[model samples]
Target: MTPESARALAEDYFNGGRPHPLDIGVYTFDAGYVAWPREPTPGDPTVLPDTVGGACIVIDRHTGEVSVRPLLPPELVAELWPDPTPR
Candidate 1:
């Protein structure tokens, strides 16, 4: 997703207006997809979505193309989330 679109989705769904990356949990950039945390921390007292998981924002870091929805599947998530080590 373009950074703006991802930021908007994060703002609308995750709360706190425009959120910093830390407001979510973990994130990864690979093959143009940004795996934004579906479970954003309740920084204040805003209601959160019932689904406790994550979503993928496909961002073309180079061209600025962006998209949301159709989050990454379980198998792909396994591939994305586990190996990064959060440096």
Candidate 2:
């Protein structure tokens, strides 16, 4: 899938049907996309306790399959893409 579409899917998967204060941000990667929650405004300092230890959402490039993985650096998550073991 294209990066734009992948990003949209990830955003929806991350935020859709959920009541969340923080917005979801997606990072593109060769393997797929990494999605994580972030403060809506930078340096807002609003405590998002729920975001602590939140899993990063990974979307497959080819299949658009979404998976939840432990929170990690985007590069590291991309490098370890397509992890077979479910979170």
- Candidates in order, TM-scores: namely 0.36, 0.72
lDDT digits (tens) for residues 1-87 of candidate 1: 554655665454545544453343224355444535555446776776656554554444565454553355534543544344322
Could you give the C-alpha RMSD of every candidate to the true structure, in order shown? 8.6, 3.5
Q: Whose TM-score is greatest here?
A: 2
Q: Which window of ten consecutive residues has the lowest lDDT sum in model 1?
A: 78-87
Tell me the tens digit of each residue's lDDT in model 2 across 1-87: 888897677677667777763566788888788888774553556655534576888888888888888888877788777764534
Highest lDDT scorer: 2
Q: Candidate 2: lDDT over CA atoms?
A: 0.75
Clashes of each: 5, 0
User: Any runs in candidate 1 off by more than 4 Å, and if so which?
Assistant: 1-22, 25-30, 40-49, 52-55, 73-87
